[model samples]
Target: MRRKKLFKMAEVLTFENVFRDPTVIFGKWKEFFGNDNDIVLEVGCGRGEYVIGLSEVYPERNFVGLEMKGSRIWPGAKKMLAEERKNVSFINTMVKNVFDFFGEGELSEIWVTFPDPQPKPCRAMKRLISPRHLEMYKKLLKKGGKLHFKTDNTMLFDYGVEVVGADKDFEVEVVEYDLYSTEDRADLAEAKLVQTYYEGKFSALGEKIKYLRAKI
Candidate 1:
């Protein structure tokens, strides 16, 4: 029998209602989290592959997947709920307003996976891991916390590395040009993070997966 895809529908509040309005989440972080535990936040968590997988692998650490589209996020949210995963949660919110959802130094780790490349020069600001966004990530991540990134776009991969290198607060520890090579595949299997829908498709197409791990 084929293995079941672990996904479920999720009910989420509006972005403005949850993060912007003080009545919703303000002073209620503990209630949302339910305990004092190390937290990892995954931005642009499409279809919830990586965050859900990581939550299963690391039950002691809480995982929060933030995405703007409720329709795209519901499956992952439902999966976590169906699995009865207490350490995982989902947030439907825009990346531009991430600061509203998280206070300074509030996260143990941050993951940016397969974000839009935004090839046009005019659309450069929209790149998820741009210098401006990296600065914002630095504010929310704890000192020495890790930032993990994976992308199939070569230009975006190079740009991310350049941006991270220019930031004094971040130090790049791992840069893999091809993450799906046989050797690398074996390494990754030992501690598999999570694979998004796009990641699986791209890998099937033989597209190289670039990865970077950095400390802030």
Candidate 2:
């Protein structure tokens, strides 16, 4: 059986509507979690499944999902709107400009789930987990904040481990070679939390999943 929709997913919590006009997000943050500290951000939030699931599991923490394509984001946004989940919000924007939406040391956790592999050597620069993106993540995540990543591509996972390892601020740990292997399935399911549309399709065809966790 299919699971119930965890929370109302939002389509567009625009900058102008949420942050641009405000001097500080503290107030809005408080409104979501009357004095809580477990805020998390998800980049490239696709259909909002992971963010919404997280919000449902940890109601005290505020969750924000960022996505560029409105067409790809609408279902999750509509779910957020339908559920009226005050703790969750969706930003309709490109991942490359995430800093514009949040301030330094503002998040306690971040997730980069199933990002495009960009397998070509020359196209590697376009991959989401590159050195440049890690720098951007460092700006927003608090010291010791964690980055949890999962993908189906082994090349991308290996590349991410290499890049994050070379960065002084990030401590790479909990690298998994095959996330969905029978012995690792339970752990992967609990840690990864939710799956995206593409992930669902891939899993149906018996594709293996890979995952990693790192601290920044």
Best by TM-score: 1
Candidate RMSDs in order: 5.5, 5.8
TM-score of each: 0.86, 0.82
Q: After superposition, which runs of candidate 2 have C-alpha atoms over 4 Å from their true positions?
A: 1-28, 31-35, 182-190
Residue lDDT tens for model 1, 29-100: 677768888889889988878878887877888887888776677666666666677777777778877776
Q: Candidate 1: deviation at residue 146, Å? A: 0.8
lDDT of 2 by residue, 111-151 (tens): 99888899899998788899889988999899899998888
**Candidate 1 structure lDDT:** 0.77
lDDT of 1 at 3: 25
Q: Please list all clashing residue pairs in model 2, or write none if there are none.
A: 8-79, 8-80, 9-77, 9-79, 9-80, 10-77, 11-77
Query: Please, what is the whole-model Cα lDDT of each candidate in the order they appear?
Result: 0.77, 0.74
**Model 1, runs deviating above 4 Å:** 1-11, 14-22, 182-192
* lDDT value for model 2: 0.74
Candidate 1, residue 187: Cα displacement in angstroms equals 8.5
